[model samples]
Target chain A: MSTIPAELRFAESHEWARQEGDLIVVGISDHAQEALGDVVFVELPEVGKVFAAAGDQAGVVESVKAASDIYSPVAGEVVEVNEALADGPEALNEAPYDSWIFKVKPANAADLGKLLDAAGYKALIGE
Target chain B: MGQRTPLFDLHLALGAKLVDFGGWDMPLHYGSQVEEHHQVRRDCGIFDVSHMHVLDVSGSQAKPWLQHLLANDVGRLQQTGQALYSAMLDTHGGIVDDMIVYQTDEGYRLVVNAATGDKDLAWMNANLAGYDVRIKHRSELAMLAIQGPNARQKIGELVNQERTALIHTLRPFEGQQEGEWFIARTGYTGEDGLEIILPATEACAFFNDMVGAGISPIGLGARDTLRLEAGMNLYGQEIDEQVSPLTSNMAWTVAWMPEDRTFIGRAALEAERVRGITSKLVGLVLEERGVLRAHQVVRIAEVGEGEITSGSFSPTLSKSIALARVPMATADRAEVEIRGKWYPVRVVRPAFVRHGKALI
Candidate 1:
């Protein structure tokens, strides 16, 4: 079973969002990382980029096998992008939950409620 | 449920990630694909290759039959146990499949791709007219490859003294049968190794013994990367039925001498040479952070565009590399379009690494 922290919210596409004050820290779930074995490269969204709605293309995660698109869980503007991932993409596989990909300033913080909660994500992934 | 190899249960017990590969449930990886690739380069690793189709050809006319059936000449195998790589081409000069053919005292043995087994057999049978040849499909056998710089030394320790002496004496591209086992010093990975074809019943026990002796079991994921790094072509990716061996970096495998010996696709290949070859396969190295994938458009400055056939993040090079078919005039530099942006890449000879050393 994958780790689904009760405090975080998840998208059906496997991204997780945690509210840290007005900004939301976003990363992929543990389940997502495991499915994508050994992340070799991560294409993080640029800062100040605007996502008009949830489930928009935020970045890309590439493994040796294939590449997967990462989606934004909520409508937001990119506040800060993870720079460390540019040099050490394996960090996504080693610590998926703790290694946040980007920080987003949500246009509407209420959009987080529309995403799946921890228990809902667990059920969605068939934990 | 797809077709299972003799080592299917053993793979499951080793916690392999199974995937569907040409109607066979094969292990994609045991845990980490990159690790397995490095293991084969730095140390020894074992692979289950029992899914490949093995066939034996024997008869009074077997020599002439193969000389006409394959692009490479069988006459080159001057000594018994010598092996040669050849391309099986269709009438249009397109590659039907590429395989390795070995000569034995009795006759010749061929190992072909599993996915193209039915088609290859049909083609071989269709061209058997007026030839006194008998083809026997050996489905009851299993194949394994143990590869690395230390592969020979480690495998030598496992077998008996006679087989061990054979392992020491077996020259590269040579295979000989010892009792029920046929061991050859040949491998797809660009490393020193042995490819053993043995009875299916003994596969499980032998695999267990190797693993118990501390050889890492590699999966198909690493196999692709290792071959790619070695500049080897995959059947569907680099050379399909629509593509000719001349454009797929396999022109060396085509035997053009002995002009009287006409092979199946010889006429078409000669015509193609006369008409002029347009596109050629080359290697692309992306020094940037993103990965290169198949079907990505490759653009040359003043030349025509081409496409990447096989692309991946090279574990050995620590960079994205690909085998691409580009315009014949493509020079030392090219650009590959990833996502919506164009990234510059360096074009080099198809090979990136060999014998655990970076070639480019």
Candidate 2:
């Protein structure tokens, strides 16, 4: 089982987010990082990018194994991007929830209700 | 539905992330894939290759039958335990599968992929009707690949000294039996190592024993990268039923001797040789700071466009590399388009890293 923090919520696609004031800081889940093996490159969403809720292919993460798409968990506008990932993409693997791919100001803050809490996400993966 | 290997339980115990690969439920990685890849390159690593198919072909007509069935002349295997890598092809010279044929005292043994076993067996059986050879699939056996430069040393430390001596002196592509285990000094990682084949029931125990001996457990993720770095082609990606060995960069595997030798795809391959192949497979190293990926376009000034068959970030080189099928006229250097940006790349022969050292 992944070391998911209780303070964060997870999307079914494996993106993890934590609510902070008006912004929701998002990255991949611990399980997602482990599943991706070693992340070598990350194609993150640029600042000011608009995102739709659920299943929207927001970006891409390429590992030594294969490339996969990162999906959006909720409707939002990108407010901040983690530029550190450009050089140290493996940081996401080392510390997924803390890596923080991008911060988004949720268009509908209530959409967080649809996402899974740490306990619910653990059950979702049958952990 | 998905199938499982004999070591499926062992992989689960090790916390491997399971994935469906060609209908088989296989481990993509045991927690971390990069570490597994590095283990094979630096130290010793073990891979559960039980999902690969092993078949035995015997009888007096074995030599003659295999000679006609395979693209390479199997009769060239004179010494017992000598191995030959060849392509089983259709009449049109399309590769059915690439396999390693080992000459045993009884007859010949072939280790092929599990996914292609049925088709390969049926194809071989159809042609062996006239011959006296009998083909038998060995699903009861499990295979383990232990690779790296320190592999034999570690294996020597684990097994008894008597078996250790035998394994240490074993030539590449040669296998010898010690009790129920068959150890071969052959592997796909382009490193010095041994591939051990034993009874299915004993697979988990053997895997645990080897891991206890400090052999890292690797998965399909590292397996793919290791093979790619070694310039070894994947069956489905590099060569398939629609692609011939000529275009697949496996022409060296084809035997063109004794002009009279009539293998399954002999005529078509001979014609292709005479007519000249239009496309060729080559290795690409990205000169820029972008990852090379499959299906990316290769643009050349004089030569035509080519496509990347397999591409990834090479852990050994710390750069993006790929295997591409390009026009025969393509230059040694070309540009690869990645997300609207063209990056300079150089074409080089593979086996980029061997024996824990970068070759280029």
Best candidate according to TM-score:
1
Instruction: Give the TM-scores of the predictions, in the order they appear.
Output: 0.98, 0.92
Q: Which candidate is the best by lDDT?
A: 1
Please compute the TM-score of chain B alone for each predicted structure, in the order given. 0.99, 0.97
Best by DockQ: 1
Q: In candidate 1, which residue pairs get closer than 3 Å at backbone N, Cα or C atoms, i.e. clash? A: none
Kindly report, for each predicted structure in the order presented, the TM-score of its chain A compared with the true chain A: 0.97, 0.95
True A-B contacts kept by model 1: 1.00
lDDT of 1 by residue, A3-122 (tens): 678999999999999999999999999999888988999999999999998989999999999999999998889999999999999998888888999999999989888889999999
On a 0 to 1 DockQ scale, where is model 2? 0.61
Residues B77-111, model 1: lDDT tens digits? 99789999999998999999999999988899999
Q: Each model's number of backbone clashes?
A: 0, 0
Write down the lDDT of every candidate, Cα atoms only.
0.94, 0.87
